[model samples]
Target: MPGTQLTVTLSGGDVADARAVVRALEGSFGAPDELPGDENATVRTATFSAAAEGASGRPAPAPSGGGQEGGRLSAPVTVTVQGTPEAVARAG
Candidate 1:
């Protein structure tokens, strides 16, 4: 099936946090094709491949249980979503 590709930017974010975000969004989009690395760069990126919608018009699976605790700074973060209109809408 033709799917959608999504690119998300995690600016001034940590890998664990980014992973958490990915986990949280797994329901909308399947596991990311590219997950953030362990590097704590000022900016990072993650690529995800999604099916737009799940079976029987239902949403995808929820994220797994696991995360870290820590405060973060409100830095500039950007998100780039690209895919079919329907897929994009579903991801959004």
Candidate 2:
């Protein structure tokens, strides 16, 4: 079956909050398919990283020019959830 990717972005400073949210999601949805059991959904992968320059609306500055700081504190995470259509719909 097809899967869904849930991406959540938060301020880089809020790492704790981000982790908490991930834990909560895990508790609610159970683990992703790769984990082990069939009862819990599988999580293909969970990644956390700082937003790169120009990733957001703000663009990076030219070589000799000055611009707003491109490297702002931002956290971007991607979680992959896999399950049947009924399960997915219910989870949604």
Candidate 3:
């Protein structure tokens, strides 16, 4: 059976947000090919990783009102999607 793989890299402090986007894509498309039943559907797996110093650069400045300083953070997320050619096309 034919399948498709999709990877999306993200940099930020929030993981939920990244997940949300992936979920949205899956919902809009379908489940991954590896998953059962979702064979012809779109399935996604997200891998999160921190970015290097030179990549993200310094963290954002501290907020006003004497709040704790915010550190620079980066997250790289890879979303692998698989599905049939028809499914992949539909998802695309």
In model 3, what are the clashing residue pairs, if there are any? 30-42, 31-42, 31-43, 32-42, 32-43, 59-72
lDDT per residue as tens, model 1, 1-92:
34566676766556666666666566777667767886747666766654444655555676555644442323434555666776568657
> What lDDT would candidate 1 get against the real structure?
0.61
Question: Is candidate 1 or 3 superior in TM-score?
Answer: 1
Candidate 2 steric clashes: 7
**In candidate 1, which residue pairs clash?**
none
Lowest-lDDT window of 10 residues in candidate 2? 44-53
Give the runs in model 2 whose Cα sits over 4 Å from its true position.
Answer: 29-92
Q: Which candidate is the best by lDDT?
A: 1
TM-score of each: 0.63, 0.28, 0.32
lDDT of 2 at 27: 33
List residue ranges in candidate 3 displaced over 4 A: 32-92
**Candidate 3 lDDT by residue in tens digits, 1-92:** 22233444433425544445444444433322222222232333442112211233322222233211242224444444444454345335
Superposition TM-score, candidate 2 onto the true structure: 0.28
Per-residue lDDT value at 60 in model 1: 61
lDDT at 53, model 1: 40
As a TM-score, model 1 comes out at 0.63
Clashing pairs in 2: 31-41, 32-41, 32-42, 32-43, 33-41, 33-42, 33-43
